[model samples]
Target: MIDITIEKNLKVYQGKQILKINRQFLSGSITKIYGPSGAGKTTFLKIIAGLISPEKGKIVIDDITWLNTDAGINLSPQKRMPGFVFQDYALFPNMTVLQHLEYATGDKDWINRLLLLGKLDTLTDHKPTHLSGGQQQRLAILRALAIKPKLILMDEPFSALDPEMKAELIGGLKVVFKGLGATVLIVSHNPIELEGLVDGELYIAG
Candidate 1:
């Protein structure tokens, strides 16, 4: 299980806001995180992934301390190594589709599987700039999975894909996630975007 109790200050148009969260996430579960704009939803995920530091909080994953601000303990993102899918895709501009996965892992079989899952098997040589918006988004998701990470954080990961494509990709991801026993947190503005896919929900108040 993953336990988190964190507080961070957010600068909004109104003023500074405190983003507080105290929750426990079960192992190998998928959770959907949604809230009003400027609610610091993305920041919440970043904090958990160790990409952002909280003013005060402690995070424990399966008895392991990932963060403890009071004790001045904070793990680097590389040490934590949670797969992250940024809203902007965050793909390497200079790398080809295959290179992205290759950067994460040397497992050729796994790379091929991810490419097929994202439906980018035919575009392995294509760079991010050469691919369409939806394709880029899919590649981002695939690259995240390439490492077979145990913790995955996705921010608006499916925003660029059509409903049909999104549905298909999610279906394939279900299998991959189960195989990897991953715990996933997805941030989306559309509440119903992950309707039946996620097993839990977290609504962060702005």
Candidate 2:
């Protein structure tokens, strides 16, 4: 399980207040972080993924300690074993879908499977600019899965896709996660979109 207890300053409309979060995330289960906008959802995920630091906190995943301000220990993002999918679907402009997958890991077989699963097989050689919004999002997800990370953090991953496309992508993700047995944490404002996607929920507030 991933255990986290952290407090950071967040800018609210009135002023700045300390955002306190303490939770335990179980492995092999899809967890959804549900809240309204500006509720510190993205901040919490970023902290866990080691992309942002908390003012005071301790984060431990599995049995590994990722951060402990009191102990003067903080691991870098690369050492955190997290596969993160940004909200904007951050794909390299110049790289092809295949190149993105290959850059995550040198496993060509897994790349091929992910390509087939994400319906990106035909767009392997196409760059990010050549694909549609949904296709680019799928490519980003495929790149994250290629790493076979211990935890997957997604920030509004399907917001850009239509309902039908979202359903199809979620189906593909289910198969991939089942095969890898990886834990997933997603941040989204739409709870309905998470109907069959997550096993539990983590509600956050500003």
Candidate 3:
């Protein structure tokens, strides 16, 4: 299980936003996190990934302390390498599609499987600039999976794909997640996209 209870003061355009999260995520589960803008949804994910720090709180995963403010125990991002797919689809402008996966792992067979899953086998040599927006987004997803992480966090991952492609990819990802037994947390505004795909939901009020 993953337990998180944190508080942070976010400097937004309007004013200081107090972001507080208290949640428990089960292992090998799918959770959909939704909320209004400026609710610190992205910040919450960052905190979980150890990319950001909260003024006070603790994060414990399977009895292992990932973060404990009082104890001064905070694991680095590299130590808690959860697969993260950013909302903007942060892809390398220089690396080719194949290179992205190669950078994550040297498992050529796994890379080939991911390429087939993302339908990027033909575009393996293409750079981010040469690919379309949907393709770039797919590459980001593929790269995240190349590491075969136990915890996957995605922000608006399907926003760029068409309905058909999104549906297909979700189906394929279900199998992958099941195979890896990875718990997934996806932040999306549109719940319709994840309808029957998610087993749990976490709503944040902005």
Model 1 C-alpha lDDT versus the unseen true structure: 0.93
Model 3 pairs whose backbones collide: none
For each candidate, give its TM-score against the true structure: 0.98, 0.96, 0.98
* Tens-digit per-residue lDDT, 9-120, candidate 2: 9988988977899888888899999877888988888998889999999998889899999999999999986889888887998799999998889988888999997889
Candidate 3, residues 20-136, lDDT tens digits: the string is 889999999999999999899999988989999999989998888999999999999999998999888889888999999999999999999999999999998999999988999
Candidate 2's C-alpha runs over 4 A off are none
- The numbered model that scores best in lDDT is 1
Poorly placed runs, candidate 3 (over 4 Å): none
lDDT of 1 by residue, 49-145 (tens): 8989999999998888999998889999988888899988889999999999999999999999999999999999999999999999999999988
Distance from true position, residue 42, model 1, in Å? Answer: 0.6
Top-down lDDT ranking:
1, 3, 2
lDDT value, residue 34 of candidate 2:
84
